[model samples]
Target: IRYSVVAGGFHEGEISCMDICIQRPIIATLSKEDSSIRVWNYDSGECELVKSYHSLQKEFQNTNQTYLQSVALHPSGFYMAVSFIDRVKVYHLMQNEIREYRSLDIKNCHSLKFSTGGQYLACID
Candidate 1:
């Protein structure tokens, strides 16, 4: 089955790519070229969360701004891993909030994925 969602938001730039949560089929995640990530419910076509680059960088003390190279949602729908210029970050989604879960110091991360069982996260630089 295919579902279409029109996320409601004002974007300074266009979206780069998108991914869906495997366990929660109704949830979708989108990454913007401007280094923002948004999570929404496809079933409702409403944006549930928005994380700007500035807000996300504040968590890691990243003085140098970076764009999101890729994003991947965990199978369980509770986690997301994203690749930036010099690091990979995992985020936890809970009760409409997004928070930094873990950080990996890796340069030029190009892609990310969660293991089928959601026990492991992998990134390719």
Candidate 2:
């Protein structure tokens, strides 16, 4: 097998965690250094979405400090889960945008993964 670079120079900081969707050419990535989540279309070499934890905290009126941990894309490419130091949040992906779907109060979650069938989300604290 061979490998090549598809996209570059998009992330300003080191990517701490990432996951790819099984049903689509979508990749979900988290950069702890920037406290942001980015969704990329690997095939088109395009960044579909970028979300900052600071913005989310402001939107939700959360004032506590926290850091990003991990990101996971659903097998169907319809959902993304992001784990943070204080909690885990699930987002719905649509039209290159992410909407808040649900929040899991799993504190200090360091890892996240969706089941192969996309029926369950597993996390490690």
Candidate 3:
């Protein structure tokens, strides 16, 4: 287990829940305090800082999130999903654009998975 102190770009506290790819190479992390998603290079242990929009926005406006959920990486390693209390935003990793994908508004969507080919997505409520 590699432990690193993560800071939520928007929120002041650090989150405790994070997920990493089983095959290694990439790491996805989520800490409730900040409600921000961080993508890192597992091999070099470098900070890639993929997305911090949610946190940035909250900090910019001085508002906070009601709930901080979990995050997951797609099997193909091309996409990532960040789940909050009731919403899941799918992101296309290569592009770094939140608008490129869809968001699933499900109650307690703490778990998300993509089929082998990454053609289908299933949410665990």
Candidate 4:
């Protein structure tokens, strides 16, 4: 079987990384070139949310040194963590919206993953 997602005009830059939620039919993609994250409902091939790092945090703007590295969706499908050059930001998913929940000051974080039980998040610097 093949799953085709209509993400033609959504991500302007090449997608750097992506992750699927274990508890939901959802997918999250990251575009390092544009510092953006897009959440999608894979079951219906719909784009649920599109948010740029620069828009969520001011420090991300006007700085070419910072770029998105990776993204991880929680097992419960209620949270997401995005890694950047200097830090990792966690967001809460609710009502088709994403809100910043917390952040970690980990430099050169290239990967992120949530535990199978959703009890912890691991970052590889």
Candidate 5:
């Protein structure tokens, strides 16, 4: 019932493509104008930007008009998940880098959710 929301810069004329971790303190998103995914820090009102959500894109998925379709957080909060048009990627919060441990390709992954227990990830392709 209590929270702090911080706003960040975005791609020109680009809408926010993201999903919230309900009841959690993190958010994930992408912007075509910026060509990146941004993971926001939402605790203690630190007002910090954990940029480098996703820095690289494959040739076919790279475009100036990309939009993140979905996002989720591992139950443990040690990791975060982001979904794109052609892939799904996870990140390690502490390392501030991609996990490089897993990725899913099914195209147009519009939504994703992590089981409360963190047992499995449900991604809608």
Candidate 6:
């Protein structure tokens, strides 16, 4: 198989987090050196920003170093998980609605992934 560039950016900073859907019509989720996740429809050249709930906090807003460290998309394509400095949040994806499903307290989380069955999630600092 051959390869082609879908989109470009993050040239100045390394990508801190990323995840992709498994099924056809791929959807990509990415986070850079900032506390925002971006969802991309590469085929359509559309991108939408997904902000972390933690970013809304007064403390987070004041800190320049605060950013998303990792991201994982559920194999079922119905959820996404992202690791902030000390917390991991899961988001439910729907046709007309998207909401945070839950959060887990994990300090200094830098990477994360969901199990193949999507029943469990793991992360590392």
Candidate 3 C-alpha lDDT tens digits along 85-111: 657788777734333377776778766
Report the C-alpha displacement of residue 70, candidate 5, in angstroms: 2.0
Give the poorly placed runs of model 6, Cα more than 4 Å off: 1-14, 52-64
What is the TM-score ranking, best to worst? 2, 4, 1, 6, 3, 5
lDDT of 2 by residue, 60-111 (tens): 3454544778899999998999887778999999895799999988998889
In model 3, the runs with Cα more than 4 Å from the true position are: 1-14, 22-24, 53-65, 95-100
**Residues 7-122, candidate 1, lDDT per residue (tens digit)?**
67645667676778877754544454455777887777777887778665555554554467788898989888888877888889876788999998988877787889989878
Residue-level error in angstroms, candidate 6, position 109:
1.4
Best TM-score among the predictions, by candidate number: 2
lDDT of 5 by residue, 15-106 (tens): 45665565557666666545565656566433233444344534435455354566677866676777777688776766445455577776
lDDT of 6 by residue, 1-125 (tens): 99966665432345555778775343545545444566665666555434544444446665665656678888887888878777888988755446789988887888888888888898887
Candidate 5 has a TM-score of: 0.61
Question: What are the runs in model 4 whose C-alpha is more than 4 Å off?
Answer: 1-9, 54-66
Q: What is the lDDT of residue 30 in candidate 6?
A: 51
Give stretches of model 5 more than 4 Å off: 1-24, 47-67, 95-98
Estimated TM-score per prediction? 0.77, 0.83, 0.65, 0.83, 0.61, 0.70
Clashes of each: 0, 0, 2, 0, 1, 0
Q: lDDT scores for all predictions?
A: 0.74, 0.84, 0.64, 0.84, 0.62, 0.67
User: Which of the predicted structures, 1 or 5, would earn the higher TM-score when compared with the native?
Assistant: 1
Q: Model 1: which ten-residue window has the lowest total lDDT?
A: 25-34
Where's the lowest-lDDT run of ten residues in candidate 3? Answer: 5-14
Judging by lDDT, tell me the better candidate of 4 and 6: 4
